[model samples]
Target: MQTIGLPGTAAPHARKPGLWGWLLLAPMVLWLLLFVVVPTGILAVYSFCQRDDLGRVVFSFTWDNYVRVFDPIYLNILGRSVAYAGLTTIICVAVGYPVGWYIARRPAGLRNLLLLLVMIPFWTSFLIRTYAWIAILKNEGLLNGLLLSAGAITAPLELLYTPVAVVIGLVYAYLPFMILPVYGSAEKVDNALVEAAHDLGAGPVRAFSEVIIPLTLPGIAAGVLLVFVPAIGMFAITDLMGGARVPMIGNVIQNQFFKARNWPFGAALGVVFTLMFVFTYLAVQWHGRRSQR
Candidate 1:
């Protein structure tokens, strides 16, 4: 009779960490301490402290900044940021998955070329690319010109400086991040597993659902986190394509430090944002462990 291991059972062939593993990880640990940990610690301290009119830290303890962050205006802005990021993540996944899959399945000689094509846009500056979008989507821009020439519409569609335009920019900027990770997973997938599923009478949809999806889930999760987290804090695209019409959480935090001169409030927002990323990372790890079981 075969025996099944309990959920919390240790791996039967687990090995202890070696000297090489510790050595390889030393740089990452130092980087986290110097850049991420130190900076976040400073931000947390400032958040619980006060800032004077000249934007100098006063070192006085206070909860006013955190309380103000929960005000209706800021909360609404946070909600909008989450919504925009969510939309961008969804779009990236939808657009990137097929491209990644195609690249992964290509002939070895052509795969590099296809992957290069995916990364070609990064040769140009991101800001420059975003500005190019401005020229294309503006009222009297290329899109309108083309439409007018074709007699498709009489007036300009007002495509630029709108939420839709911001979403477009976000999706364009982050699609590569989503594609690369998924491609990594798809490239490593064994074709025989898929063929075996087919041989066992599994339909195309069933094979994809039961086999491909599970195998590529790690890459999907990685891509989602990469796209969603950064999209939430992107201020440039929102300011440019969104016309600064609406305030997102990113804009609010930026405004606090610049226009409002409220360093404490900005620090508070940063702390909260950092904590959110930590929680999300933990949740993803937990979910992966559960799925493995």
Candidate 2:
């Protein structure tokens, strides 16, 4: 006798998403299309178009804007931006990893308190915070006054309106981005695996290098991307802290739009800047996958 197959018992083919699923995703899809996709498309179109004397984007297309992007002056600015961003990423990784690790190893109550401290800066406006740094770093400011009073220096130090100040601002602003992701990764790390390494006669350094580093690589990658990307495009800090004397890529792009009245050139620079980020991220992901083998 042939056995009858039970109804709704056998595995069904994957069903097509119903109206409810689409409705749930509708808001996110609309948001991306409106804000991200549409803006990006506009930028791309503007990059190829010409700007009139008034900096209005003209309908006519031209390669002059893109050509200017490769000019020596802009190229130098781009290089400087990369150097600043790279240094910031390195410093963030060095400082944030330890802070994240320490926080993760703490008891839940203390861990939460430490995390809250990290987030406290976010409660205030970032612009206000940057301005506060200006007060502290300027000549004859609090830092210089303290040093002068203590006889640490014969004269007030000129710390504000310099490259050093720009780096400081970048590091301060992005450090939390690095810490949060690292903490998420570190908190999930298995203590048993670390203990096993110790039991197998591995030293702390060896275990950290061979096991912990590998485990937390994802967080490190994320933090680097977060810090590096924004740092490359940072304009306000460079302008406010670095005195707007030294030109960064962001400064150049901003000048093209507002100062020089060259909207097409600005758009071209922006397009190239965005593409660089996309390529860098893809390269990182490829390297990560290759290393996992």
Error of 2 at 277 (Å): 0.9
Q: Write the per-residue lDDT of candidate 1 for residues 186-280, one digit (tens) a residue.
A: 99888999999999999999999998988888889999999999999999998999899977888888988899888888999988888888897
Indicate the TM-score of model 1.
Answer: 0.91
* TM-score, per-candidate, Cα-based: 0.91, 0.93
Clashes of 1: 0
> Given candidate 1, what's the lDDT at residue 255?
89
- Residue 78, candidate 1: Cα error in Å is 0.9
Q: Evaluate model 1: give its lDDT.
A: 0.90
Q: Which residue pairs in candidate 1 have backbone atoms (N, alpha carbon, C) closer than 3 angstroms, thus clashing?
A: none
| Best-fitting candidate, scored by lDDT | 2
> Model 1 Cα displacement at 195 (Å)?
1.2
